[model samples]
Target: MAVDTTPAAPSHPEGGDSGGEAVRPLLSGAPAEEEGEEEELDVRYAPYARRDAYGVMGRGPLSPAQVARLVLAAAFLLPLRLVAGVFLVVAYYLVCRICTLFVDGLEEGRPRLQGWRREAVLRAGRGLSRAMLFVFGFYWIPMSDRSVPNAEDVHQDQSAELERPGAIVSNHVSYVDVLYHMSASSPSFVAKNSVSKLPLIGLISKCLGCIFVQRESKGSDSKGVSGAVTERVQEVSQDNNSPMVLLFPEGTTTNGDYLLPFKTGAFLARAPVQPVILRYPYKRFSPAWDSMDGARHVFLLLCQVANYIEVVHLPIYYPSEQEKDDPRLYANNVRKLLAIEGNLTLSNLGLAEKRVYHAALNGNSPRALHQKDD
Candidate 1:
């Protein structure tokens, strides 16, 4: 039988008077491609995300809010550093006095005991210095990276030729270089004697087996630095510690994009001179610059300073046994090695083909301090 094909009564577009309404698209009034494009172009924000368009490492341009907050924070914290510095100095002096008395007592009628007690006092000083550094590190400085080599690796290279202690030479990028080396390895420093007069900081340096030389004053004073280095190597051997001395060959801080030629004194330290290359993620604002005036510059830096601080200990170099006595040639080879490893170009960081003495290196020069120093 032929079935009847008849249409039902028409319903309204909105399903008026019907049991259920017609289904509509979840996203209405936009084509699929258009919807996708809109989603792709959306700018998302996360709380505390780093500000964009700034240098990855150095402080970038700041907004008014950032500047205001930075000022307020500095006003709150500057006095604290001052107070801490003063307190540390007083306490360190007292401790030194007590040790001196004990050493004097030990020396009475027992000459050999005097030497032992002297070393013990020095050891205490080194420990205190390290403690101070830890305290300093906890300040608003946010370190991005500070990884050391595996203990196994540090040992393997140092052990290759155990005839004498090896020297580690690096570019002196900042005062933080000292702390960085201390944190990674216990090595004697090749430093200038002027550092010994700096109150609390000077005390810490002395404790760290720092060989202080008069960079300008010659004869005995100059010889003292090298002599101390040799003595330190002997001390390390007696203690059965890693054979290494930390040497800042550049003798000063730089932008860090280009390494300054080394000061050859470091090569005179007994050993196979190992070139230790320390690099921050950004060459401009590593904590190494922390000692620069320590007030105004730090104030500007703490206020949204570099995005991060990174220290990389590059390869260890062992100069041929022949070059140990000839420091200049030793330094030249180490510099050449670093140049090759860095693969730096003149325009790499907008640096000139040759380094020129900028006012920054001069102690009396007006610094890039944000606030005027009266």
Candidate 2:
């Protein structure tokens, strides 16, 4: 049998597709060794390839048609979004209030709560997160992969000493990642230290057991965080419901096109680690934070009718003999595994470098809003 080898040219209306993401080839310049092998290469990394060269916030000027769409969307959604934002903030505050009273140690200098009181707090946090997601039109698409091959199910790992997720390492991109992860795992995050000072947000984050870290922090600050992560991971006992510590190893956000270099912080712990991947698919507005101001990003996201998030939770990785001894190697190995599974290509640049790149492109620092306060 002879197969048609000619490629079919794509035909479209004046406007191209806008529903699903359009994936492009990440690999180029390689000569095809054999027929059909080029296609295999294209499809390999296609699912996570980037179509635009610039970051999400560098979406450039909108066309007149796009401007009209934005205006219309804002006219219809502005009032509703404001109301929803207020309602969510009030609801979150109330929930945190309840958590402080009932949840042990959440009140500060207190011991851990026993039994139902603790459960009540956990349930409240999860419920609040889901409510926030609902208000923002963020919905998760669930998927998983097992590079470690420890078991078929997450629950099955309960029998092993690993038990429930002790530490979670994920690729960072958006603020919404916290909401999704909190709802899913009830884990404490190793967040940016600035998060601990953001008014009501900071207070609530502490109540939720979040561990905030200073970026590239050194001396006592780094040591303190290292000890904290170690303590949190070690605290995940045999109980399946015990809390897990979460870390975004990229140390900052990207446009979701490339996987940034992984920081070695999370691997400092000896406990079992869980790798998580998150992608927010968008057409109207991207949820990925880049050079955009925070307030503008929030408004853009809230104005959208619907937004989709994709989650991939890989199996819990028990440290091999090599990983057990070397945290740096362990971090790199886990990062490589995630990049392959997530269909993400590794980028040499980290978030700091990206910020500089963004500034050069825009002729202003991405941190301009912050600098303005000075």
Candidate 3:
């Protein structure tokens, strides 16, 4: 029987796949070949073979010494890390609760803690978040700030009217990305609505003034979220004291090796944004959140004796006249810059391709899912 090597159609939603570019298919596996025929697979699809993004499955089986090391780490380090991590989290939650006390309308409108209360929360949050990362074995983080000075400073042209940096945009790789950002700059994030209901995190997220949205909704609900983000971006640009809004233009996590197509919501306001790039250089297990479950990722991360992270802070990106008018152009241009500077491959795949890859990896048919919709 001839093997079917045809690529499945990507099922991306509107506003998800930017630029309407043709996305390379996310292949689950290579087709079977005849007895003596050598199979040649494209290197691009190597990341998708294991059904998870970032090719954790492709890392192959562990060596005997590696297994012994993991065993020892699991026996000793895991317990200490767990206890310390939990303690730090609970302590931080108490601090947030106290800081938010007597402050009304926090649960209602856009929560912005002012004066001493804001300072208290930001300081405590940053300290505790760093402690938590330390407990997880991120002892030291090396950061590179390659950002250029503001155009206004370089050129004495008041007529230019360059926008101030309103938001910090970065590619999402793992949940750990939030901790680093919190410690670096306590900026508000764009998070899922469900995150607001999570036990310890929900309250903390609200205190950080996280903009919540339903990720699954594609109708007017999404548009409302976009408008809210734009308004917040504008507010940040105008108010020097407002917390910088942090947005992940990719809208989802990847393996940290590829940059996905960006969603235009972050660029809708056309405000200047500080682009940040985060990388996890690991020898054994990767810290990227692409295909791993939260529990397993955390457990493995703690099991390791040490972990490494590199953060690159690029210069503030101000949109040009044409880019300001076209949000897509602005988003794509930023994505391209990140890809080149970060040495990450540019992928046309978006959230939809990720879902399809996940489903196929787990023994489900993506075509069947699409068939039901049809």
Candidate 4:
């Protein structure tokens, strides 16, 4: 017998009964909330959202294939990379110690190292920094120079001297960002006072003429770190032989997608700055150091078979008269320029928001959070 197949008549029309409100399709793209209604606050909307900060690591459960890849990497790659990294650090430490052997006044303050000693330290530091990055799996780095009449094209004479920027301002994304900068320019950096006490790295930092800040001290500003930075900027501008001062005006790392409000410390002297933007384009793992613990970051970084960094160098930015009179104006203008050139989102959220996000991720109580100077 043939089966009957026919459509049933709808109890109500598509718009529902004429007097009733229209029925919406289940798959309709319209938002559930009414227009102009205030939406509830969500972690995902925050600039430094925990999900974005953690990248693929926090993206739910891993597949069996992913688990196998990680297992293989840990079993083989991790040990070799760790050993090579340590060896490079120790070898570079010895070189730094030897270079600074006859140099005095480091204990009192930063003293200018000239002649062969300076050359030896700078060259060795650059080479070893690149080597360390290689061990960590950054085999290739692509740098793009977008400076008008690029710094390299300028003649090495009075004109060049006058045009040189006092400092290189870049966004901070990870500790590896330091390695790239060190390899490229061997510039001095502003670091926390605690970093000056770490083994091997402490002496290396001092030898690099790093300016150390007592970040925990309430009177650190009065203690001369800011004054020293201003003086160093001026010094670098005037002295051709002086190392370029590198400052992360953001004062902290982010997820590499947003640019935070820049601190005025790097622009206080009103010296021209060469803005360099660094980006790590990744597939499975993000190279950003936003929310990961140091050890875990290192482990995953080494586990990855390959990684990449793209560097963009912008033209030297000169402060206008108004900016010169106001450091905040100088900083904001540069920040805006960087945001435009680098295609980065300008975020009002700064380090405080980052700290709160991290605290929440780690399950810390709200009261346990403390305000930190940016």
Report the C-alpha lDDT of model 3 over 16-121, residue by residue, as the tens digit.
2232121222332424442111111223233232222123333334558767987999999999998998898888788778888888866763556788888888
Candidate number with the higher TM-score (1 or 4): 4
Off by over 4 Å in 4: 1-45, 50-60, 109-111, 148-163, 364-374
Report the poorest 10 consecutive residues by lDDT, candidate 1. 42-51
Model 4, 112-137: lDDT tens per residue?
68889889889998999999999888
- Write model 2 residue lDDT over 1-374, tens digit each, in one string: 11112322112111223533332222232345532443442333221223332222434445587667768878987678678767776777666666566445654422364566557657877887787787788754555555355454423434464445568888887899888888876787777777766767775677567776675666547668778777777776345555777788887786664576677667776667888888777665667775577887787787777777888888777666667589888888888877787666566655555554444334443346236433
> Which is the better candidate, 1 or 2, if ranked by lDDT?
2
Candidate achieving the largest TM-score: 3
Give the distance in Å from residue 351's predicted Cα in candidate 2 to where it truly belongs. Answer: 2.5
lDDT of 1 by residue, 79-111 (tens): 565566467557765655454553332222211
* Counted clashes in each candidate structure: 2, 0, 1, 0
Candidates, ranked, lDDT? 3, 4, 2, 1
Overall lDDT per candidate, in order of appearance: 0.45, 0.63, 0.72, 0.72
Candidates, ranked, TM-score: 3, 4, 2, 1
Better of 1 and 2 by TM-score: 2
48 Cα displacement, candidate 2 (Å):
14
Q: Tell me the TM-score of each prediction against the true structure.
A: 0.55, 0.74, 0.82, 0.81
Instruction: State how far residue 63 of model 2 sits from its true place (Å).
Output: 2.5
Off by over 4 Å in 2: 1-59, 102-111, 144-164, 192-199, 213-220, 237-242, 364-374
Superposition error at 189 for model 4 (Å):
1.1
Error of 1 at 318 (Å): 3.0
Candidate 2, run of 10 with poorest lDDT: 1-10
Backbone clash tally (model 3): 1
Candidate 1 Cα misplacement greater than 4 A, ranges: 1-63, 84-97, 104-161, 164-166, 191-205, 216-245, 282-295, 301-308, 314-316, 337-356, 359-374
